[model samples]
Target: MKLDIQHETHYEYSAPLRYSTQSLRLTPQPSAHQTVLRWALQVPGKLFAQRDGYGNEAHTWTLARRLWRGAIHAAGLVETHASPWLVDAPALPSPLLYLRPTALTPFDRQLLNIGAQALDGAPAERNLLALARLVRERVAYRHGVTDVMTSAVDALDIGAGVCQDQAHVFIAACRARGVPARYVSGYFYAPDSPALASHAWADVCIDIPGRLWLSVDVTHGCVMDDRHVRLAVGPDYAACLPIRGVRHGGGEEAMRVSVQIRPAAP
Candidate 1:
């Protein structure tokens, strides 16, 4: 299946920014399950600076920029940043990944306790599948419950969240269980649906035989398919913003993101 995606983000400042710099990770990855035929990023302002590279990683800015005297609008630019990397999750020592407990991050420790209460003696695979189902069934998939700043624990505590929140919980659980998990930001095409929406999911690097990295959609409770377009992969949202930027002389800034993803006509 082939999917065409168009994502546009606009930032309107209360006052003109003195200077601006941005880091964009909007390009998709071409792996075993999907392909990237064509893509582009449009910014209707000046082309001050940008960071274009491959792989799933985050950005950090040490210096800020001053605003130019004139308004900047950069648009309609083709970015040649695509890779045909296969999803090959290398196998880990079975003893290390499962059937044994490992050191955990502060957040991971809390998740382990939750899993112990919610899922006792359930195998890792079964636990993940069950967790995914629970997320969809228990949480009301509504807007306004969460924003970009909402954390995974907060969403779980509230019993409500969007796709990103679900993905975070799924990732946290998998990693807590010693499985190598990551966050996936991309587009999901729901056939015969009213409109398209940008989607997020989880990928676990199960060191099983043959396949290395497997993608899982906790929001939908299934494996990702052709309808699942790959964008970026990282440990969490901090590394997964499709587009990021920094501006100097910030009095007040209003950022708006409108992503329109649709299927190509047959």
Candidate 2:
């Protein structure tokens, strides 16, 4: 399936900023399950292209002039294959690296309990799906209740969160049981569910020796399919954020994001 995606992120600041720099992980890389047909980024400053620590196609955008508003636009055409699992080509970071805990995915007693219940059986694909389902049931999908800084434990405690939160909880649960799991940021082509267009999911290492990963959409409690266009993978959302930056003097900032995904014209 070919998908044309248009993403726009705009920021407005109460005070002008003297300098700003951002790391962008908005570009998608070709894999066994997806191919990037065409991609581009439009921003105010020059974008320095480089590969991030996780081997994600990344860019650094820097603006030295004073500004009160900024915008970033990313447009791309990608073709995704219908694959139940993603096999990572032999890469730098080993699967064991993902098992390590991060600030957003710290170990917790409640998360361990959840994992213990869902993973009572063998660590098969079905059991992983059950773990995702359990997360979805405990954490109801509700907006405005959680922020990007919310951790897995915090979201589990609140009992409500967005896709990111759910993914974090699922990752923590998997890691608690000595499973290698990582966070994935991507676009889900669901016209009826616009909010899901900008989505987050999890990738569990089912066969570490074979470098096979099972991509799970915890929010929907299913494996990823052709409709999912993966952007970046990391230990947590902070590492895979589409745009993360710091400014010198911007105060009281407000941000708005727009994402549109549709079938490409032949």
Please tell me which predicted candidate would have the highest TM-score against the true structure. Answer: 2
Leading candidate by lDDT: 2
lDDT per residue for candidate 1 within 158-251, as digits (tens), equals 7888888887776666556555667778777776542336788876655544435667788778777666777786666666677676667757
Cα error of candidate 2 at position 65, Å:
1.1
Model 2 C-alpha lDDT per residue in residues 165-262, reported as the tens digit of each score:
99999999999998999999999999899988999999998888888888999998889899999999999998899998888998889999999999
How big is the RMSD of model 2? 1.3
> For model 2, which pairs clash?
none
lDDT, candidate 1, at 130: 79
C-alpha TM-score for every candidate: 0.73, 0.96
Model 1, position 155: C-alpha lDDT score: 74
Clash number for each model: 15, 0
Whole-model alpha-carbon lDDT for candidate 1: 0.58
> Which residue runs of candidate 1 sit more than 4 Å off their true CA positions?
44-54, 57-86, 89-110, 113-127, 191-196, 208-211
Per-model lDDT = 0.58, 0.92
The segments of candidate 2 whose C-alpha lies over 4 angstroms from its true place after superposition are: none
What local lDDT score does residue 146 receive in model 1, on the 0 to 100 scale? Answer: 85
